[model samples]
Target chain A: MVQALIGIGIVYIGILIVLSLRSRREIKSSTDFILGGAKIGLILGFMTFAATLFSTFTLMGMPDFSRTHGVGAWLFLAFSDAVMVFFILWFGFYLRKRIGQQSFRGMSSLLQDCYQNKGVGYLYFTAAFLFLIPYVAIQIRGVAIFLLEAFPDFISVGFWSVLIVLIMLLYSELGGLKAIIYADFMQGTLLLIVVWLVAFNCLDQVGGWASLFEKINESNRALLSPPGPKGLLTPQFLIASCIAIAMIPVTQPQLSTRLVIMKNYKSLLRMAVAVGTFAMLIILPTIIIGLYGALYYAEESTSGFLGTVLLQEQHPIVAAVTIIGLFAAAMSTSDSQLFAMGNEFRGLLGASKEDQLTPVRVAIIVFAIAALLFSLVSSDELVLLARLSFSGTGIMGPMIILGILSKKPMGSFMIWFSALALLIFILSQLNVVPQNIYSFRVDLALMILLSLGAFINYRLKK
Target chain B: MIKNWSERKLKSTWRIIYWSAILLIAVTFSPIVLIQDKVDPHWLQMPFHLWVSILNTIVLVALTGVGGYVFYTLKSKTDNDQNL
Candidate 1:
């Protein structure tokens, strides 16, 4: 088992290195480094997005959730995706036309241009990198754990995670955007295939759809629908879920630039529908793995149902796939987050005196390394941090809609709104958020409402 | 004339079906996207996770519908140009 795992790891690393080396050849210009020379086709773009979006957390956690929460577990994926779908619709066509007017415009640059505030623009640059670095670390650590079983005690999970981060950084540094995109294309396909394998294994074991649903009901009826746990009910849940969905376009840096890359103005809405659907389709297997683990293990005390599967079977490959999914998730998030951060800094930050690709590669490596360290020193893995952070960014709706509208003074307004949103989210996760409004719901409605108020105020003043 | 109309209608038929089916699944699965299922329900006899399938059902349909519209529109435009 160890041998097989080891073999896969070495081979996988080699494949990535070779791919990155070739991708490096294309980095003749900054454009090639940043957006794959701005010559991405639909397939590569889709794959890159999917690769970045789909990852280890999604891979292992979906199954874990199915086991623990049942049907309601998928709410975030279904709804949050709609935000991106809407974004693609709203921006893809217009932005394609807009990009035609400008040679190179990153998301932050777009914001700064629209808002007409350099300070606010720089703030966005700083904020994106600040939040993203820790986020990427969580992803790197996740991949490391997956690679652990393959290694001797010589390389700890943290080491493996950092090693991969370095690998990504090296390629990203050398090969630039071309390397990341091509690698993303390869990684994304592997992730999809892995998803299918896990899904198939789940289906075969669970006895198909009819049989699976039967199992769901047999264990807990409440798991099948909303108002799930009597205590889980709250207006906050519904609102936050929706707002989170609506805000997808703004929060995910990888998502925003996709529009900048597309050649046609008409493809946005089409891509939205397609990508939204694609996003949901990809989410299915993780949920299945979660449900399957819940049923087979039936261990209420299991830390995570997906992890329990490994303990029960001692199946290294299956375990590896799940781990890889987590890695994929982290990689997806890290690469995109790094990519977005790099783009933001190359223009707005004080350190804009360099090639865009070089800064970006350094930024990605630095962020990934920091995240790994934080993951090692911090409380939990990226998955936990991601979820907690997601609940925070879930309110990114008001920020994107309102901030984008009024590029006038009141940079403070946007910053405060984002800070307040993050505060409410943290409080909610910590279970100290205003319980008087409602009980134990981790609500963000009031905060978003307040942000919306501020946005309105900004506009009124404008 | 009816055959031509029939073909056109057939082409658009997927739009409605695709949209509706995607919506159904998305709606059905919204309650569950990526949340952890704590236990099995009383109704079913199996222990399988339906979240993946539920999400897949919705997404696949949405793609079929929305993605289909793009390709179809592009194709129709070319056909018109060819005739022109």
Candidate 2:
């Protein structure tokens, strides 16, 4: 399994390099690089969309959470989200229409129109940039650690993180989004193939569904467990996951750009269905792996295969493979993020547009290096940070959506909602008095409702 | 002023929306308000994962269907009438 995993990994890389070469001709301008001349079709858009959603945290962090909370933990993801899939469909169409002729940063500028406040737009953009750097670094390290775990002697985690970053930087600096998408299509296919293989093998190892459940029940009878009445599924958490997944197309800048490139309503609709279907399907293997991990290995002890697989005994060859798959997932996300961030920030800060691209690429290199330093220094915080960093948009989702949908001119409301969301996020992190979930929920809820009101009022005024 | 056709359409839309809201509220309060005495209220008994999945699937399918109908049927109807 290890040798085969390595062989397959090599072929995946080789294919991407070849595809990147084919796309080199298309990489001249920043526009060509970032938005792919606004010509990205459904396949690239759908794959890129799929790739961004598949990340290390889903592979590792989710299982980590499941260990403590059981199947009910997945609900933390499945429910508690309300924006619904409306955002997904709306995003592909609305943003595509809104972003035509605009540079990537120009899209953020449109938030000024929605929020009716340039200041709020600027605040949102700045927060987004600040949040992405650390998030990108965590993803880079996840891939690196996967390498370290898989081939302990050959490449250290830090060394592998840098290597992954360089590969990403190379393709990104060459053609930007054009290069990235071509690579994405390649990586996404590898991911799909690998996930399906691991899932099948793991299920076979666990002796199919009945035996799997038998093992789970035998392990302990807890409701949601064998004895538990709740079962493995959680309704509230599923609702949250659906909400987050629906919000992905809107809140994720990298995924949202496809809207700008999509030629028309038909393309947007096609990509939405394609992306959504692929996303839900691709995670099946990871979810199965996660469920298997609960029934097979101890949670914290199985964080990676290094100690259990290499030192004590055979943990599971499939686990070693899943770790690599996870690495692929994380690396794919990091590369695209680096590319997108480099594109946007380059244009924002560089003396010229071309210079912007250069700095952004350099920044990605810098970001990866910093992550390596931190991982070596204190990886605990950095490793767990991606899932938390994901909260930035979610923190502002209700308020931002309100601005988007408001019927009234809400130039002033943007600042209030921005402040409110920021307050909710900060207060949640501070762990002060009350220390209750509602502190975060009520504040976030307040922000969402107020912003919605502002938006409706604005629309009504017209 | 809006015509009789538009007025009737608005009235029916509101009617549907009100009924939907009532049904949703019933669903939301089912465990607590209606079945409070019957349902088990324990961390041990919370079927959080299973029911959430079922509800999410339901809501997801409903949202997609309603969205499809609105854009395909209602929006097009509005556009067609304007053209006429």
Candidate 3:
């Protein structure tokens, strides 16, 4: 199994290097490096966007969540993603129009132009750095843990974590964003294939889908219903999950960047629908794998359960492919993020065009190191941490929306309010402040208040 | 005034459909509001909640397909008119 995994890993890395070398010829300027020349068509756009949105957490966390939380896990991701797709459609239209009005390089610069204040750009970058670094760390941590479980004797989890980050930086430095997207197209395809293959394998082992659920019902009825037996998927929890997930295109820089760089609105629209379909197809398999775990490995630890299902019980070859798929998922997600951090850093700079790419490259190396350190100490709750990243960055969603939609410039006061709201949310996450007010989650409440303040401030100015 | 009103109505029609679809899906799948209990008549051996969630997914996907089709048709028409 280890040899097969290493062979496949070598091939994957070889392919990434080849793609980087091929794309490097096109890297004449910062714009070409950062935005893939900003002319990506429908098919590549859909695949890259899907790959970036769904990552290691979806593959590893969703099944574990479903196994523990019941079927409501479906609503947690698939339905929430559906809602997000709708928002992307509308938001993309407004965003494109806004970008047309004043061309900007990245989200931070776009916000700066919209508000006519540099502070807003800094605030956007601050929120992204605070929320997104840990999110990237969790992706690295997820794959590290999975690999450790698969081959405990191969190397330490830290080594795998370091290796993943190094690979991301190497290719990203060599080929830039074009290499990342092409790599994403390949990663997304492999993830979908291996996941469904494992999912059906689980079903076959459990007799079939019908009998699988029957076995689940017999053993644990809660796995079939809301809140599961653990009560993790309550209405409020799912609602909060929906809001956070829906805010991805509005908040997450990597995803929002993908939305902007598509060839045309027509392609964006097609990409939106394609992502919705992809969301359902990718999540369906996790449900099968989760239920299989619930039925058989109910008492096992997470590492133990996943190790058994993903490796011990499966054929060695399947296990090797699954490991490669996991690596692909992690790299596709983390590299996009590390690259986005570099892009956002460039936007923050006032440097000349010729001086931008080098500093951005240096900043990316710093970001990767930060993520590696965080991965070493990060929690194992992949889904929860990812959600926290979503809702934390969601603090800026209303700001972005108002910026895109409003004809007039927003006040500097709005940026202060956004900064304050983000501070409060971070405090709540740290438990320095309570997370709920009148039964509403702090992040959700802050989002609504800041959004209303944005609208009201705009109205009063008018 | 009449042209403005017609255009406004046309635009709001899609908004209305969009919101209604969202509401319908949210209501059907929300455990606190509906399907709070596991019941009989399971489809594909999935419980009622799971069944309804899948059903809602289908509806959402269909809605997405329709929305894409509408955009595609409108875009083509605008292109043709511009060419003329």
Per-candidate TM-score against the hidden true structure: 0.77, 0.77, 0.94
User: Model 1 misses residue B75 by how many Å?
Assistant: 18
Which candidate leads in DockQ? 3
Chain B vs. true chain B: TM-score per candidate: 0.37, 0.35, 0.56
Model 3 docking category: acceptable
lDDT of each: 0.57, 0.53, 0.82
Decide which is better by DockQ, 1 or 2.
Answer: 2
TM-score evaluated only on chain B, model 3: 0.56
iRMS, all models = 7.8, 7.8, 3.8
Q: What is the DockQ of each candidate?
A: 0.13, 0.14, 0.36
Can you write out model 1's per-residue Cα lDDT over A1-462, one digit (the tens) per residue? Answer: 555556776776677678777877767766677666765666666766666665655665455545655555555555456544644543443444334546454656766665565655655555455555556665665556545543445687667766777666665676666666666776666666677676777778789867766776677666565435443422345446555545545665666666566544444445556566666767766666666666676564333344445433446675555454455456556767677667666656433453645555666666666676776765433344555445454445455555555535445566565656555655655577663354434445555465667657676767
Could you tell which candidate, 2 or 3, scores higher by TM-score?
A: 3
Ranking by DockQ: 3, 2, 1
The CA lDDT at A405 in model 3 is 80
